[model samples]
Target: MILLFAGCPQSSDKISKPGSTQSGTTIHGEKIDISETELLTALNLTRGSQSASEAAKKIAAQTGKNVGRLSFTEAKSLAYDDEAGTFKVKVVGKKNGKNFDKTFNVTGFTHPYASPPQSAIQVEFKFDAGIEENLSIDKYIEKITPNLKAHLTFSFSLQNGKAITLGYDNDYYELTAQVSNSNGELKISPEYKLKYKKKLRGEDETSVSTAYTSAMPVFTGQKKDYFTEKDVFEHIFNKVKDDPELIVADAGSYASSKYAFAMVLNNGGTLFNTGKIAQYVNVYNTKGADNHREIKNITPAMDNVRGGGITADDYEGKLTVNFYISKAEYIADGNTPDDKEKSGSYTVVRSGFKKLPSDISSNVRSVLEFSLGKITDGNGTQDTWKKRRINNTALISMKYTGINSTYDNWFSLNDDLKITGDTSGFYLILNGQDYTSRMPNHQDNFLVPTNGDENVKILIKHLQISKNVGEEELTIRVQFMGGNDTETVKIKPQSY
Candidate 1:
């Protein structure tokens, strides 16, 4: 059986830095010079997927301080300062059910600290260690396959004080054979193995998948401040009378396709004005469906702030709007001049204004936009103009590479692309319409290079264009230090 999987890239973005110069007094009123090696040992004891409270006890014992019931939520890093002869370890969690913040500086060891390699949690398939069975290759395959599967069980505790078990009741196991000789004599060789597929990513979901054991936070449901279907339509009807043109197309007709409308609020105040803007646009197609529009509140986390730099509290917020439109719907709605006049469809044009918070810096507010054309063709037809969006923007181009061959080479826009110009800011304008929303996909859309010479690969899953589209063309506009640059590229349709 053929199985498709979307893999996640390891995060290379530098986590928040640990405070260096803050030297605190020890319990006995004595100064401690914590060595890097000792600090790393303490951090490793309380790393993620481990018992935080238990590790905290061990750490307190090692450091001879009252570290107290320290709960480990995320382990940032452990760096040694040769000049200061101290190791700074950044950790974010709770102590005694309250927020705890501190860096341990152990004295004694003289060697620099060596951090352990970061890795994803591994899942293993273990046969009955006691049972000894002699069977042919066919029998072995049959026993391990879904046809004659054996239940696997595991349990883990969640942050909310709940326990969950897998491979029980409705949960079953499915195995895929990876051996070279399926018909050969049965042998349990270490080289031959079967990989697990969790079916986490949906068929139409266009983004990379993180490993089940990844440390990154997973967002399962709609954000806390998202608008409901009723909320969306109510706002639309309230504003439709004043701006009749905003009701450009029928939401019912376009709801069948895989599209989305999103709004992002970054460094902004509240969701009050954002809901009003949704109503003013009148873009929803269905009366009460959740798929139409998405609203996101982008704010810096408190844990990421170091000393007194730029914290989430400093900036108000940034608001972005994203409206998804299919090529057929776009043509049918007369968004394109050529098709608009030929289709003889009435066009709706609407605009809204927002007042930036007085506290926000003027330099933070800048104009950035992106557009795409010939996004989809239903007839399986190809066109010369049907290519990736490439322009003078950052002197970069994109190509539609197929799925990853190995986990190490997984596709990640954040890991690959290297932008080196004076870039003020950039935003993707969904639906190829200038007046639409600046909805950004937090996982894949906003990308910044980690290094200068990094060769970034643009995977097929990262592009917003649907694989059903015969030939997809995407354009991106980058606002550099000097002027705006627009670049477009062509991508051939391929399944992930």
Candidate 2:
């Protein structure tokens, strides 16, 4: 079947505000509404199919309880049926060592296929401990909620013992197949498989798939009720098949796609393998979705300084420190003005150090450092990184990092969380002004002028220095202001 799926990227921005809605909304003035129907339509599924109901009923039957329906459900489960064409199955399981109520509402329906269109019932369920108790489950909840363990399965067979075409998708990994003869009896057999991708340097694919099946059978025509591997696979496969994304890899495709797929499977989602044809699924989509960057301001806190030496009057005027930061722009490769694919943020932070006379009293240099912690993204998760393991750039600390109060600097920025990527310029900013002039070797010392060019936007300025020789404290006030940001810093004397 030609399934047209819309791959939408999820907003990683963290909403510190607890009341933030989980709907498709962007922090940066972007809003997108993706209804469950729209999502199902995107995955090329029967828009009105009560797949979730079927899955829920199968789960209820396995757990031995009548799990009810949810008012605000995203996806519907499969269903099951009894001899009289009535589907009413329930399953019961312990959660956190306690009993919780889970209901299934799988009702058999008539469809067009064979003369008396075979009534097929399917169901799905997952064992969830809690949001926190299950880390993998929580990740899924964060991405796709209500906390689920593994989706259970159930299916209906026809007169010829042929199972109908059914599928599932967690929007990442999926499994689908046309069973030739499945109308015999209900059987459950748990199976396991490992999925991997081919990595560079002949390395194995960095993806793995874990399968768990509950060997419980409901329609074995036996007094004892239990599920077999087939039932378990069918149970989990039904919900998983709904995702529609489970696909094979195409050469030259982005590796991030594999990472996204692995994440889905790792989070209690089942995947199906459709031999012969490859599946091309979108893990994330920026089009028609709310995905924006979030920025925050975090000035330096808990400050302390240190002294290196003292002067004639038993004073330490030679130990002065100040904090500063540099800003610059980068031209992304293959990025055009119309593309709007800029991938880095202008970071601002604070750092400082004491000034000590280097060699002969004539030459002096301040041992200062700078920090770029002022800008905080609403998404507090640490940067997702990949180490390049290649060293082609020089490493320097805060003070010596930027230009010496001269020459505008820049640094290359990219979405990759590695610092070893291609770097851009490193311009200097003196007192909230761009140091555009080249560093001059003039014998006289003068306050560096700021670059007021249209390209250079003043981010911070109005820096002042104060010192109390007696208390061994040095206070530096930086009236640094920025576009959509601002901050101040103060440092006291201490050890190195």
Candidate 3:
């Protein structure tokens, strides 16, 4: 919306002289002068709703000059000054071989922003040379024809309880008339084309963004003048009222019917150093004692596993215990006869798990053993392992555990969600986090299921990971109900 006020001079400045060609020189070969008092009287008589030609004829009659002897070249009015109760109009006319441009300090002219009947819209005119020759309204209309076939359009809006006028300036040789619409918001854009002898020359346009007000009476059967704020609210409410899934409630309220589960393992084998297993169990027991008052009430026996022992067979088998232990010890008899009576204890252990221990619900001791037989049994590269770990972790972490159907559908339609990097749809997740921050405030945190069905569609909006991870295919697994059925969708690597 760049506004250019090019070629318009200040009203206080003198009107530019017509071209120096002999054709432009005023007729009668001598300068003619009309008294200011007579001119003022004629102008006053023409003030209220009189066409420019009618005013010209009256002025010609009073000054004893034929209407053909005058040319109305320019006219402009300053903004109304309420305190002074006056508005200034500058007019440039040609008469008797001389240019007569004068500013009339006028009172009682209707203010464009005045209230009710007093606030009528007015138009002042300017014409090219010789256009005012016959001095009739029809003759005036004939000279300045629109280049566009349509009538001049206008839009209106109220600013601070007053109408803000939008029109082209006088320099463009275009005339404007005021028409009003009751609803400002319904106003159409105003555009006009200038034509000469039916050939298009130029255009003038204006746009309005405001609520409409009636300058004149609206017809009896027309729609109400304007839309109220409540009208907008009800319109939106009616659109979504029938959708039961769009209602919002707390996630925990539906926990009885909804279930979400996730698990991750490195090759499905569990291992723990025997000497450090006791310390790990003790730590878990301490954490549960310090943090889990609710769980303590349900499982009071959880505190009794601190002194448990790990046998030599457990160490050889690489078994994983399901209870907490802080540390472990190994005691051996001294080898020398002198030291036979003395026994010493030493800690010999490897890496320990950092996560809190969970109850061992299964009894398979071989579950911790690798089916691949040994560490060197397969073609296991670090790059492949790293990529698999990253993909596995990402797949498990990306889950829509609960339902969210109250999101605004308007935002989903308009915003760019980058579905498949080529198509457009709602973005559910990016880099394992919800895409809610990119959406508007009213939209929910998660995407809704399509019509509350068992199948969930996950659009892979984007993928950005380390180059070392290579081109990995991702599998999205969705479980709608607890152990009922699972749906899987595979997404291949795509170029950005």
**Residue 210, candidate 1: how far off, in angstroms?**
7.9
**What are the per-residue Cα lDDT tens digits for candidate 3 across 1-496?**
9997879644332212221111222434344454444455545653333322233334434333334455556554422232223333445566665866554444442222333222324222332211112122333334434421132323233222433233544211232332234333222223222211110112122222222233333211122122222222222233323332222212212211111100111011122223322222333333332221110111101011112211111112121222211111111121111222111211222112111112211211111100111122333343443253232322212223332332222122222222323121122343332323322222221222221232331121112222224533444443321122334444433221
Tens digits of lDDT, candidate 1, 354-452:
222242222212222233222232222234333323332322222224423222222223211111211111113322332122222234322222111
Which lDDT values do the candidates have, in the order given? 0.27, 0.24, 0.27
lDDT rank order: 3, 1, 2
Could you tell me the C-alpha RMSD of candidate 2 in Å?
32.0
Worst 10 residues of 2 by lDDT: 306-315
Per-residue lDDT over 109-156 for candidate 2, one digit per residue giving the tens place of the 0 to 100 score: 221112111334553433221111212322322432321224334344
* Candidate 3 error regions (>4 Å): 1-80, 94-105, 110-496
